[model samples]
Target: MKKAALYLLLITLFSKILGFTREIVLSHMYGASNISDAYIVSTTVPTFIFSFLGVAIATSYIPIYSTIENEKGIQSANIFTNTLVHFVILICTLLIIVAFVFTTPIVKLFASGFDKKTLSLAVLFTKISIFSIYFIGLIYVFNSYLQIKGKFVIPACIGFLFNFVIITSIILSDFFNILMLPIGYVLSYILQFLFLLPFLRKHKYKYKYSFIIDKDTSYYMKRIFYLSLPGIFGASVNEINSIVDRTIASRISVGGISALNYAINLNSFIQGLFVLTITTVMYPIISKMVVESDVDGVKKSLNKAINSITLLVIPITIGSMIFSEPLINFLFGRGAFDSKALSMTSEALFFYSIGMIGFSLRELLSRVFYAFQDTKTPMINAAIAIFMNIVLSIILSRYLEIGGLALATSISAIFCTLLLFINLRNKIGSFEIRNIIISFVKVLCASLLMGMISRFFYYALLNNINDNLCLVLSVCIGAITYLVIIYFMRIKEINIIVNVIKKKLFSSFNVL
Candidate 1:
């Protein structure tokens, strides 16, 4: 289990690095312009669709498929796969049509502050990007299948390829002087779908049209819908919160949307690398344990996940907070992204970084409930968080501009995390509360030390060279310092990561 998590984490980390590089390219090419804002708003539509449908499929189907795989074996699981693929394809197609037809209204709904030209651009981007929905849905199903089959490497690398395609498209747009942004996203999804075809073929899992839902299939589907309903609600909360931020930011200035988007992108990159990787690796394992009624095993896995997440994320969050300005300037200082944009984005990133641990915890703990097939608790909590976010965002945006939006999100995430943890303890009877507390203390202390080291190095580098090189140097020094401190602390979990790399290296050498 540790090995699997480590492998997935390394691949996820690589993908995130590529994703960040993609962001850097986007910053240079588009900066914090109205076009970038339109691109951001346009991308949100498919993403919102994905969060609503794709998340439901992933959360509901993984445990259901795992259960079938465990009890009835491979053939039964394949049936489930075929049924789900057909269902998702139909649903995604319908959604694409709805999105296309309502593109203008939907864009206006999300970006209410946009004027006529910006609204038209957002609508155009959304219309173009909606074509990727079915392909995106197909990729999700295939990726989940690969994950359940223990083929983590390919699934992890697939997202990196998607980012690569987007980066290429952005470059092409610059050369042609045409808005090829949405085209890049569409092509990426197509490529992602195509890339998984061979794997599906190897597994002999061909997509078939099956409108005939049997009693048993319908039963499972209904169960899935019940389980996934909360996720949909939760996703709605997120979308609403995003719309609130974008709307408020849109009122601020032309680049307001872009600033918020850049900061949020950075936040997503971190969460995807650490939080998503941990949750993905753990969810199936947790589900299997739940199926077997291994309560102790569940507790043990939960503890390890919590410890592992805190050990990695605390330092990164603190370091990012301490060196936020340089990091932002280093990565996005060039092109139309000016010093003012960097400052605004850096401020948002600092506050957002404070919520990293909260978001990471939320991801892992929410899955714990999902593994137990209890999604309603998370849904209820998400509703509360969403309400808090909207109320606070409206009240705060009046004073703090875009930074207020980011701050509101951070506050809401922390609130959600606390609520989830408390409710999880009640549901599970008891957790490793003592260990969690102690481990968090250790990680926090270590993070503080690392933050100081990062700050010192950041200032020193800034004094020497206020350019991209200094930004790069500061990140390196901060990372090295954090690792060294953690090493001296003898965090045993770190060895798990090291061993996985060693195994991969040996496997590669043997192939050579």
Candidate 2:
């Protein structure tokens, strides 16, 4: 498990580096402008649709795939996959066509605050961007299969290829900037989908034209649909939240949608680095364990994941809050992104980062629940959170604008995480709740000290040093302070981290 997590972590880290580069380029080129706003809003239709239906399929398909392969055999599993793939493609393609024809109304629904001109531009972009969902939908199917086979590396690193192509597309957009942007997204999605074909071929997973569904396929398909019903609702919670935020943001100003996107993207980049990496690596194992009725194994896996995420995310969350401005300035304060844009983006980042721990735990916890095939619990939890978020967002946005939207998201996340944890505990009995709380207390102490130290250093070097250098130094100071304090304090979570590092290092040495 540690080894698989390490592979996923390293590859995800690499992809995130390139993804970071991609965001920087996009921010510099477009800033929080109308064009950027329209572009983001344009993609919302496809994003919302794919995130729900597409992600639902991917999230629920893997465990069933494992079950079928175990019970029915690989040939049966392949046929199941082939038929499933064709069905998803056919459905998504039809959806895309409908979305294309009705682009204007969809974009308007997505961003009702857009003016005539911006709405027109968004409609155009939507026409182009919606097609990418076809590839994205296909990618989800392939991703489930790969992860089931314990093929984490390539699936993990494919985002690197996606980012590389996106970077190239952004560079080429100079000649026809606005129109080229969405086209680039489509091209990258295409390439990403194509890149996975070789893996399928290598595994001899043929397409087999699966129109006639056998009994086994029908059984699994029916189960997949049953599982996917709640999965869809659970997954759509965030999409629903984003839609609410974007709609409210659109009322703020022309660039409201763009500012929100930039902030959320930055937050996602950080979360992807560690939180997501752990959860992604754990999902398959957790699912398989649940299938095998390994209750203790599942508990151990969840605890380890929670500890790792909490330990790593504490420093990042606190550090980001302290140095939000410098971080934003360093990453995106140039080109079309001005001082005002940086300030708003940084403010949003601060609010969003405040809930990092909650978000991290929620990521892991939700998967654990999914492993138990109890998606309804999470769906209910998300429905409650979304209600809270909507009420909070409407009331708060009047004052905080983008920051309010983000703050509402944080509050809802923390609420969702708490409820999920309590429910999981009640459902599974107990296993070191007291210890987990103690570790969090220790982490909080360390993070507080790190935040103070980083803030002090940031202000001290404000005008004296290069902006980038100063930002880097401040972050280093915070991270080092947090790690040193945790180490000296002898926190329990620190040891897990130490062991992971030790194992990773020894493995590297053996390979060399």
- TM-score leader: 2
Pairs of colliding residues, candidate 1: none
Cα lDDT tens digits for candidate 1, 1-512: 76676788888888888888888888898888878889988888887877777876787788888787788787777777777888888898899889988898888877888888888888888899988888888887888887777777788878878989999999999998546899998899899888888777773543343566545566677778888888776545557677788888888878788888888889888888877887888888888899889989999889888998899789888877877887788778898888778987998898888788888898788888888888899899999998999988888777887788888988998999999999999998788788788778877887898778767776777767855676677667777877787777766677666677899999999999
lDDT of 2 by residue, 1-512 (tens): 77888788888888988998887888888888878888788667787878877877887887787777778788888888987887798889888989988989888888889888888889998899999888889899998888887788878878988899888877778656668888888888898888988888874654444467566578788888888888887867778888989988888876778777877888888789888888888899988887888899888877777777778888888888877887888888889898778878888899989887877788788888877777788888989989999999998888888899999999999999999999999888786778788888888888999999988998899789898998889888888888899998887767767888899899999999
Q: Whole-model lDDT, candidate 1?
A: 0.82
Superposition error at 286 for model 1 (Å): 1.0
Best by lDDT: 2
Error of 2 at 115 (Å): 0.7
**In candidate 2, what residue range of length 10 has the lowest lDDT sum?**
203-212
Off by over 4 Å in 1: 204-215, 235-237, 488-512
Give lDDT per model, in order: 0.82, 0.83
